[model samples]
Target: MSPVPNARVLFNAIPQGVPTPGQTTVYDSSQSIDLESHPLNGGFLIKTLVLSIDPGMRTRMRSTEEKSYATAFEIGQPLEGFGIGVVLRSENPDVAVGKYLQGRGFLHQQYFVLPSLPFGMFFLDRHPALPLTTYVGALGLPGKTAWAGWKDYSRAKKGETVFVPSGASAVGTMVIQLAKLDGLKIIASAGSEEKVEFLRKLGVDVAFNYKTVDTRGVLEREGPIHIYWDSVGGETFNAALDNAAVGARFMECGQMTTLNSVGSHAITIENPMAIFGKSVSIHFITSFLIIPKHLEEFNRVVPAALVAGTLLRSPEDVRHGLECVGEMIRAVQSGETRGKAVVVLGEA
Candidate 1:
């Protein structure tokens, strides 16, 4: 067997207010790293590919009360997220070497040295019929977010009308498809004209450019939306409130539109009057706090939907190399990129 060679790891030091060229840091290797043989628990080394750059990451980058989800990325520590990786070495029985897996909290490194349990690892077997990247996209977090939020929070019934903003995004697209499968009438809004057309092809009953037309106005004439699964909060969430049916359910899953700010321009709905009067329920959803029971249910429901034709998988937007990982964040922030922007670290 060949000896283990040195690995290069890159980390984001000093959070810049905005992403510019040559602002982040890249290291050859840290000499401080003890390579000496030591007992490793459930040990595994992974070569990362297709790193997930999610909006939740933006909150984690900050140092505030809202950053309670996960500890903020340290100035000199490896940045982390859900990523697909190939196992290069392993001491764990469950995780064998040479297998591919999807891992959460994986940095933008070419190789990872995991000392603890693979708490977030989901074994990704080769799907001959499907692209592997889908494990990090449609069959991944975004897809899971759509599925879990809709299934648990919305509790959507058949023949109900569901409205989703940012409907062309990776999660949004999956939500649209899942809602349709539940036999719900799907109405969607997107930023651009092209996205509107894209949603139409996905069987959306009414796809509109939210930038051109007033969402609430359009919905008022349309009448009685049963569920509003919001991916983009701020104006979109406020607008959704206006169109919500008497007993409608609303799921606040994400806050992409407000960037990282906490302020809400939300008009106070008379909760005791309008909502209590109408008996509508508002639910805030996040997969981060999901319990083991819910996660087990997720593991079963998700893979099955993916293996079957129930969920529609969107193509992943891949950015090559660890250095370009910032571009993935920028794309989502700018609202320029469609679907999930993943950084490919090594060759597939």
Candidate 2:
């Protein structure tokens, strides 16, 4: 066997702020591997097709001392995330050659060997209705996170108003759909006009560009927000607290506004009293907590909804090639990615 290209995205530096391509992350295409001769142990080799670049991953790209739900990415090592791929060779019978699999912590490489299908890796049976990309996105962690939050944390009720900030994102879009389905009025916000338009397309009761409008004023005018499905947790989080109605529920999923501050600093709530005085309940939600409890139900219901078009796969900013992996990371951390930032590593 001869060595062929096996390039991967590497963690080049620990960012003090918003990570930059080449600075924080670097695409290294110089590496190569002998596919047939590479040690697989009892696992297999996979050819990656698509990878999901999530906002939460920014937390992982930090120093170990900083800490996060997931372990920090090591500098000068291949970075990892969720992706779907086709098995190229196998030593494990549970997974077979040519079968598609969705994996957690997949090295961001064109091709690599998996030790085994551990906790978050499994073979996926190809269904024409359920695209592989969605397996890493809307129907993936973001979808599961949205479903779990709505099911267990949203505390939503019919006719109540919910404010969904970051409303055009993967989780945001899914949450909006779920809230609308359950008869909630959605007051959603996004940074760009395009995202606001997308929220409107999802039939949000009120959608606006938070960058230009008076966010607090709008919240005070239209709300008494019954539920705040917050992913962007800097200014919007405080605004949600200020305009929150009595006994409002806050489903705290992500904080993109503070993503870059993981190692250096933290954000404080502007009005802490609103949470206490308003009798608001805050629930921190994560896919890790939810997946164990609801994986079966999520797998059963989500795929069907996505296939039936009741739950549209969240909009994606799909890019091609491993070269753009760093670019994707930059966009996701900087909050410029319009949707779920995904990288097409190869044709599935």
lDDT string for model 1 (197-235, tens) is: 889888999899887998878787775788988767766
| Least well predicted 10-residue stretch by lDDT in candidate 1 | 30-39
Per-residue lDDT tens digits of candidate 2, residues 135-217?
Answer: 88787788778888898877778999999888888888889999999999899988789888888999998999888998899
Error of model 1, residue 173, in angstroms: 1.9
Least accurate 10 contiguous residues by lDDT in model 2: 259-268
Cα miss at 258, model 2 (Å)? Answer: 1.6
lDDT of each: 0.70, 0.84
In TM-score terms, candidate 1 sits at: 0.82
Name the best candidate (by lDDT): 2
- Candidate 2: lDDT over CA atoms? 0.84
> Which number leads on TM-score?
2
